[model samples]
Target: MLTTILFNPEIEHYDFGPGHAFRGERFASFRRMYQETLAHNPHFQWASHDESATDEELGLWHTQDYINMLRAASLAEDDEDSSVPEFAALFGCGPKTGPSRQSLSVYVSRDNLNPLTGRLPEGIENAARAIVKNSMLAVDYVLQGKTDKAVGLGGGLHHAKANYGEGFCIYNDVVIAARYAMKAYGLERILILDTDAHAGNGTCEAFYNDPGILFIDVHQTGIYPGTGLIEETGAGKGKGFTVNIPLKSGSGDAEYERIFDEIIFPLAREFRPRLIIRNGGSDPHFADNLTGLGLTLAGFWMIGDKVRRLSDELCRGKCVDLICSGYNPDVLAGAWISLIAGLSGIKVELKEPVPRIAADEPAEIADIIYEVRKVIKPYWKCLG
Candidate 1:
């Protein structure tokens, strides 16, 4: 059975307001798609977050001071105007840094008012903990031979840093789950496959110098928090552990699939990880306003299917997926459904045209991949 973990209640408090581009409706859209798909397919076994993680668990990847700061901000209990100044400086909640009224226009209708007071509710920490806990549960379930693959649809806050939260993310759920897998489950080699529109900067930072974790990110170049250059391989022992493939803005099916075949697959074979984690983000669709990547729904299905096959072949059918970034509700829904179908071994047909190429894709991207292969060739098999 496919174990699927969902933090449905966490979506309620994690709102970025009605007008924000990262609106809550995206989850609703995904839920709709899930229900529709389930009506026809009944292989999935849905599970929710059971026990919230404790402060000690969260401290595995986050600083205690940062956790305290978030807790204090949530307990302020002040008005929106009053709370803005205090939390803004501590948590990057200002108009310049945080989600502003303008960004809301992309997702919500005009004239939407801010519902969140820049402060979380009493159980805010519990909510973040729940996301991490559910992810960990999914991993445990997969590792214990209870399931071959599992997915957490409500986690994958990749942009969150070790000390501070950003990009609508509070805690880096995937990092916490990966850590649990390594320390608690006795998994030596772990692979994180991030196919989001944005880079997995936080995850990269956490395991930058650790050879135990193999991190691979394929995202849009020159995007927000931009640091996933191909040359930024790892430092010291982690030199070849980190692989970044910054794709061109409009790179759709061909470019993405090519990178997977040439780079990701070969590297995974070399690493021979015990478990594989996927950061699945659907914001690269042409319909999404966040980025310019023009991947179709079918394209997403193909990539998801390919990743699933890779995990089954290389990692003994142990894979866990976390939802990352995806804004456009329609695109997010369609792409997520397609991914779920592929993960369940359902065949899909591609009927759409290939996406247009981006104008800003530097010629150096290819060169960067070549250099990365050279650096990591000794560690992984099938690199030649």
Candidate 2:
């Protein structure tokens, strides 16, 4: 009956470095903004996740070798280790760019430091455990029937693979959560919807062989980690279950919502999954520096509204939200405020300002949106 939202100061321990886009302050600002917005609200109960994921728990999807490799990298204490090239890459620090080991310690071990604190973040392993375990805690609560739904005030680290990390994501929490539900709760069908600017590459990879997991990714085309293509549907039993809706550069709200209605919604209705997972990334907002896809505050509210409605109809209101990836402070704070407001059933003005894409971009976006829907229409009855 309650929608439990998970936000703890320690989640910020997953910080990359000072200049990196995935900084801890985003969580801090969002917490400040979220608390102020949802203050005195009766529909939402805010909470913290106490469980840190053990290696065994992480082994639900990640390999023991990958886990051990990161633990070794975390020991470096600085990012300058050239001896282990593969290990450096695991921490998002390759030969060309990344932090020195000191940058690795930038936000860790700071239970006494600023917000998004860690009791004592040893490094990426500590932060990864916090993110994944905290995410699972929310998942566990929803699956156990203690709460109907939960939203994590955490990044959607969907870019991490089963055996490696990529794109600032060390572990794929979306995949882990879905797998967790299936194995622990014995639920067969799970739906993962990723709306990040980048494709849910890692997530799609992990579940490509399994029919029980339906993965949907809607992202800007040709971006970093560009693997989600129109033809890359699921393989084997999972064939056609993996849906990739690649929006053209600068796609706007109308374009995005159209694809969702024609493609995503209809498929979801047909799938009738036992649980719904949303990787709520705001990087598509016009103001986000990473990508050009256009999403305003109203648009974000629409996404949350649509997803919430679908969960209520298809899954008895069971959903886990891993809020992720909006770069601008205002963008992250405002978009989330708008989104959470919708999910909580609160009708009010999200005071954050909305920015639009370039004037000419909307027309181009419309064409791209229509094309994407057409590409998938043959596979899904809802497209018609």
Which candidate has the top score in TM-score?
2
| Tens digit of per-residue lDDT, candidate 2, span 283-346 | 8888887777777888888887788888999999888888868877767888887777766567
- Work out the TM-score per prediction: 0.84, 0.86
Assess candidate 1 and give its lDDT: 0.71
What is the TM-score (0 to 1) of candidate 2?
Answer: 0.86
What are the clashing pairs of model 2?
A: 9-116, 9-117, 78-101, 79-100, 79-101, 109-121
RMSD of 1: 6.0
In candidate 2, position 150 carries an lDDT of 85
Steric overlap count per candidate: 4, 6
Off by over 4 Å in 1: 1-5, 79-125, 348-368, 375-384
Maximum-lDDT candidate: 2
